[model samples]
Target: MTQQERRRGRDETEEERADRMWGELIQEVRVAQTGVQILFGFLLTVVFQQKYASLSQADQAIYIVTVVLGACTTGALIGPVSLHRLVSGRRVKPQAVRLASRMTFVGLLLLLVTMGSSLLLILRVATNNGYVPYLVTAVILWYLVCWYGLPLWARRKHSSDG
Candidate 1:
């Protein structure tokens, strides 16, 4: 067997593994939930501002899309918690963890899109320069690198190292 396989937590049963995974997932969800909730709260307030009426039709459309994306992101990030609560007594934690993990992944993707859209809208309003799209693109690339590329690269490298 590979060293990695040997080192895997063979001591833990499926229930224990699920418990450990659930703890880790909750920790991760806490961070993301905080961010999305805060962002969504801010987005909610934007429509109430007087300046909201002054936005161009295109900008208004962007704002609407951004708000919806933020709402969806918030929902996805919080879904795991609700799922856990509803299924706490059932003997389905392993399945719950899997489902929660999927929800978290989807939440992160939505968060990424929400952030990108928010940035695009803000930049578009803050600058009339043609470089707004380029700037947004650069920032999105940076987000991708930080959020997915580095972890995936490490996963690949370390998995191969075993």
Candidate 2:
């Protein structure tokens, strides 16, 4: 059967759509949260490293900003858990799912900043090369393409005909 003919309530009832979307959203968050948590955890310990004390003032400033971004990433990623816990029995899964999805997106954005800044600090310290900024910019652009550009492109390319 064609797409329209096989659908009940436009391919799914509200509850069904919510359940499916929530499951998918949770899975995506799990993937994002794990990476962010690991990176954030490592960022948390940087200040204790003996090398951290020797960093230039500029590098230290960069490290601080990176760590802050990492913390934001962690919070946004964990936001969904609190959301689910608070709304579990309230029959508001659909809205919860939407809000969680937005949080996850914000979390991903923060993760990108965390990663880009971390890379910048590392490369600057490790090489002190004049080309580090260019290299970091390239890496950031690559990340933008992979993490955001492709997904957005696909979303626009394959949207439903509604």
Candidate 3:
């Protein structure tokens, strides 16, 4: 292997590494952006529905909060693209990638909240069962496990293996 490959697992310079990471980050952001945007669109229509007026005050409050969370999630997920556009050719890609990654992470967390709140509101409206909160909590835990816990566990395990 070449010296650069031996040092970094690829025969690429810092610029190349930054380029690859930026591409990967954009692909990841696209997936998240699609989901959040769709969800936000649906949320926007909820308030206009005739059924929405029949919802309890507390449920309406939950709906409002969920919509706001969805909006914030959408902004954060889309932030990286705007960041890249504004910073292109500025020779600060590495720093930009780092910031974009942070934005994506925050976006994901907000997405988790948005989904959880949406689920809670839906369940509360669909059924009068006392088990709604518990069910929503369980689903939130599942999202946590799938979206974060498992990846973190695997990262910790495999990083040590290397």
Candidate 4:
């Protein structure tokens, strides 16, 4: 049987489906990777700034966590390219694409955490008020709604309608 015979959905052969799916996944990952890499690079430079020395202990902790999360997000977002490079021509394109999608999802989550923590730290340092956490949480909720919730809902709704 050809690759298409192995697939669980539709009539696409493995190669044809992988080719189509990989292209789409790559496009999605490209957008995510660019954003995370830029954010991660910026986070990496923050610690060397003179202003970093004046941050409170809590703020410092948040900074460290944010940076670490950014790094992880960068790694995950870039993982698909390396994975495809390593597994190319091995007849594992479907598996690689599946794994890459998971990585992208994880990277997005990490990016969210990094952004949320960065916001908390900045707002805390800028305002030094009890409302900092509330504001950060609200922004985080917005991110969740926009990034994940809406997309998932739309997908399900569209698919069901189809």
lDDT of 2 by residue, 1-162 (tens): 665564433578888899999888889889988898888888889899999999999999999999999989999999998999999989999999999999998998998888899999999999999999899899989999999899889878756533
Cα lDDT computed for each candidate against the true fold: 0.93, 0.90, 0.93, 0.88
Off by over 4 Å in 3: 1-8
Error of 2 at 159 (Å): 2.2
Return the lDDT, model 1, position 157: 88
TM-score for each model: 0.95, 0.91, 0.94, 0.89
Q: When superposed on Cα atoms, how far off is each prediction in RMSD? A: 1.8, 2.2, 2.3, 4.7
Q: In model 4, which residue pairs have backbone atoms overlapping below 3 Å?
A: 3-14, 4-13, 4-14
Q: Give the Å error, residue 20, model 1.
A: 0.3
Candidate achieving the largest TM-score: 1
Model 2's lDDT to the true fold?
Answer: 0.90
Q: What lDDT is obtained when candidate 1 is compared to the true structure?
A: 0.93
Error of 4 at 83 (Å): 0.3
lDDT string, candidate 3, 81-112, tens digits: 99999999999999999999999999999999
How do the residues 1-162 of candidate 1 rate in per-residue lDDT, one tens digit apiece?
768666683679999999999999999999999999888898899889998899999999999999999989999999999999999989999999999999999999999999999999999988967999999999999999999999999989876775
RMSD of 2: 2.2
